[model samples]
Target: MSVLSATDVRRNWSQFNDDIVREGPQFVKRNRDEWVAMSTEQLKAAFSNFTFHAHLVQEDDGTITATLDQFDLVENGSSEKEVLEALTYELIEYSQEYMENFKLYFHSPNRKAHFPYILNVVAQDHPENVRQLITCQAGVK
Candidate 1:
């Protein structure tokens, strides 16, 4: 991963974009915080390859809404912490169910032939996600 200051990014915006286009991702720092810059293809591949990003939004009704858009999943709570915890449990439950169905269908020769390669691609990019899904499916805490 490449790291650059905020000023460096502003001064060399073209070069930075070029680098991300050729390379992958880069980190830019602004004051105490840092942000990542990646191409759309990179972001799409990351999300489609078993990675997830959760976003929290505050509503006018005094509730916090947490959303993981990749799966079209949403959870609401009174506080940010509550919503996040809910999202975690929801993801685990959903993954377990998905794995259960996948395992059942995988017994078929056609399904077995096609799905494993896709899963293998995801596993190659995000082994942790694959492991977590299988582990969650096993009903392990």
Candidate 2:
């Protein structure tokens, strides 16, 4: 899990996003003291939560906190959005693993039975994003 300050969040949004999917969750510091978290899925939910810091946890009295799962919940729609967000995150994460790094943890025989179909879908949907990520890492156009 990577940690970013509010300023870091603004300056390195894409890298921060890569970290979220590459890792699992990220912490964002506010006012340089308090912390909040956004999940890999939450960042892609960017389409939904256009508000910066929208994923921060809110207390009964509405205070921001560092909790993660709370921030990943989808509002203002049916569960389909949540399902789609989860699928998108999985697509990005596994495509990075399989396409860029050549890692095949998901392809292990024991795991293959459960993950094969999902892996196939990710391969189909995210090859371009995977290519772009690799190109960026390689300093190529």
Off by over 4 Å in 2: 40-141
CA deviation > 4 Å runs, candidate 1: 1-50, 103-141
Residue lDDT tens for model 2, 56-108: 23345433322112123222212333433443454456545555443464556
Best by TM-score: 1
Q: Tally clashes: model 1.
A: 0
Kindly list the per-residue Cα lDDT of model 1 for residues 37-70, writing each as its tens digit.
Answer: 8876676466553444566777888788777644
Per-model TM-score, in order, reads 0.40, 0.25
Quote model 1's TM-score: 0.40
Error of 1 at 75 (Å): 0.1
Each model's lDDT comes to 0.62, 0.42
Clashes by residue pair, model 1: none
